[model samples]
Target: MNPLLTASGLHVTFPGRRGGPSARAVDGVHLDIGAGEIVALVGESGCGKTTLARALLGLVRPTSGSVGFAGAPLSYASRDLKTYRRRVQLVLQDPSGSLNPRHTVYDAVAEGLRIHRYAGDERAAVAAALSRAGLRPPERFFLRYPHELSGGQRQRVVIAGALVLEPELLVADEPVASLDASVRGEILALLLRLRDELGLAALIVTHDLGLAWNIADRVAVMYLGRIVETGTVEEVLSAPRHPYTRALLSVLPESGAEPVVLAGEPPDPSRIPAGCRFHARCQVLASGEADRAGVSSACRTRDLPLLDGHGRAAACHVHGTP
Candidate 1:
């Protein structure tokens, strides 16, 4: 894919607290976000979705592998990194936490411009960004604080902060997770509009499959710091090949399928299991399906090849067979 952002064999490791095993926060991840394309990085907590997004945004250095932007490999040098970050921005999950209560909306949105030493009219840029983010009558919010606006409005302000810089890519971490149900749709629509109008690509980091279904063109299902499935939304969500993906979808209130209540402990980054990394709780293996297919032993003993996170694929021995 001709992508605006790309990660190849990306791995980010953090030493465990108290000298425990190092946590593989992001391990061998590969992803591509094309211009105007919205790719959802879906996974539960500690599955490394956020860490992967941080790596892509150049917030954290990868322990191994590489990140590329606009066909050029990411540079970590001070000046180059600053330039690189200016083209990519992050929208955090909580509007309340991301926004500075001490700063007025104007100051919050203008912070990036000030940091980048923008050369144009700061007031006009802030107004244009706020308007672009759907905060109409931009001056109305110039004096407001985070507590003065609704959750949706606050989120719009946060988005405006990112847009002020005119970034090519937005890595939004659960952009609407903190909003009320009625407000959630608004934020999702805003993201879509930004893409359609400005040709801005986004990697929305969320665990909500339903959200991915509504806003994303593509979905990458991550588990234990590795992508197990990747494809167009219709392909992966409608016909999910990975067992973990299937389980996640089944739990959605609208899926109608019986919920696949996963047994065993949740995935641990500090001590990842061998084999499928998901084999311990796989329904197919527990139901004797993998055994019938003669792959149960492999699922417990063999690790699947690292996924390049491209095309319609699943990295499962029984289902995807990579």
Candidate 2:
């Protein structure tokens, strides 16, 4: 199947203060989202998941590499950029921050239509969008301001605003991270429903592994600006091959196994560790066991590429060599 969105070797860097080295937020990453598919981009904070999403949406220009949509490259030139923005909408992390506090729900949802110059009736479009986002009796909420609604209702308003654009793909950055735990499930279910009902594809950036397990068809584990592992939800989460992935899953409250506590924080992006970026914190490399697999030197001294084999891909020297 042809991907609706594809990004390859994307790198985004920000110049440092006082003439220091640049910070490589996104370092040589690649990803794809097929039509009607839901892919979860999961990682700890500062791992560049959000930066990659912004690049994919054309909100952030990459320092290097290309992003393609529907088999053609994305061009930032005026009209093309506008059209791409219309096709790919972003659902931000914080509903309160994303929505205008003073704007009524109807105005919030209709703003996109006006900005994009929709030829259709704005009221009907807003109504349909609100309804699709699970805001039933949409009329009841139309005149209410952001402050008048509950947290979940506010999030629904944000989703409705995105739906108003009728976008083909949604780049939702931590869509549920700010909501109450009870509200998280509702938002996730809404995303699933959007995919099933509207045939919308989504690239959800989140730190919650459980959220990925709940709604993602595939999971890509990002660490220190790179995708360490990627595979179907069952494959990556059930039997993670990468040591980083295993450590992440091992700490899940329900995993039963003792949590594998990683030592030290992730290295700074400006001064990334040589070779395998995760080597300093990798328990496997610290222990003598990796030597038995004959990949210890490679793990510490060589930059492992994301090797694809079997049904999944991982950037680890000792993967599948037990």
Candidate 3:
């Protein structure tokens, strides 16, 4: 089956001053989210995860490439684009900030219906939205303020707001990052259930690989604004081939290693290095470059491309051969 959403060769950059270098926030990002599938975009902060999402939502226009929703190309002025927004909603990381403090839970959840002009009585729609979000006995939450509810409840209200529109796609950006660990699992489970029950295709942007391991059908590992690895959860997580992917997996706590220490920080978007952006921090265990760390010259000079292997693809010269 064709993907529900497809982003090909997406590139987004902010123009710098006449002489200054422009910032490359997203570079050649290609992704495909199938119907009813949950694809996780995992990366560190400032890695353009949010930028890619905004491009997908048409909130930010891409400098190059295309974003297709369903089967048609997504254009800013296209009628399909407007319908796509309603069919694809975003649940922000911070429910408190996303919802208006002054608006009661009912108003927040029903806002989508109000905007979309969904038929029937507003009150009935409001209560139904609450019920669907698991805020059962919907009456209780309808009258409650955002501050009056718990973190999980506030998030549910946010989800309900998105669901109220009956969207087929949901872009959840760091949905559980701010919540306490105890509640994070519950929220993640709720998101998963929504997909299973409502057939929602979700693009979950998160930094935690654990979250993706728990909920995603596929995982895409991004580094320096590019997708370094992509595959099913088992293929990418169990046997990640990219040096960056390996480094990330090495420090996963459960990777059974004594915390693997990575060298240097991620490259600045404005001054990205030539060739392989990750060369600055890589340590090819068997390549005799383990001691160089950030000081190594080989990493600073070489470029790697996503190579097919073991039922997945990873961009790392070291793992691509032998």
Pairs clashing in candidate 1? none
Give the per-residue lDDT of model 2 (tens digit) for 1-322.
7788998888899998899999999988878889999999988889888889989989899999999999999999988999998899999999999999989999999998998899988889999999999998999988999999999999999999999999999999999989999999999999999999999999999888888999999999999988989889999988888888888888788777678999988888898877788888988888877888787887778887643312378888777432
lDDT of 3 by residue, 1-322 (tens): 8889888889899987786898889888888889999999999888899999999999999999889988998978867567778989999999999999999998888888877777888888788778878898999888899999999999999999998888999999999998999999889889889888889899999999888899999998888888888899998889877777777777777887555567768988989897667776666743565434342454456565533212367775555433
lDDT of candidate 3 at residue 123, scale 0 to 100: 85
Candidate number with the higher lDDT (1 or 3): 1
For residues 144-183, what per-residue lDDT tens digits would candidate 1 score against the true structure?
9889999999999999999999999999999999999999
What is the Å distance of residue 234 in model 1 from its true position? 0.4
Runs in model 2 deviating more than 4 A are: 306-311, 320-322
TM-scores, each model vs. reference: 0.98, 0.96, 0.92
**Local distance difference test, per candidate?**
0.93, 0.88, 0.83
The parts of candidate 3 lying over 4 Å away from their true place are 78-80, 285-302, 306-311
Arrange candidates by TM-score, highest first: which order? 1, 2, 3
> How many collisions per candidate?
0, 0, 1
Q: Which runs in model 1 stand beyond 4 Å of their true positions?
A: none
Clashing pairs in 2: none
Q: For all the candidates, what are their Cα RMSDs to the real structure? A: 1.1, 1.7, 3.0
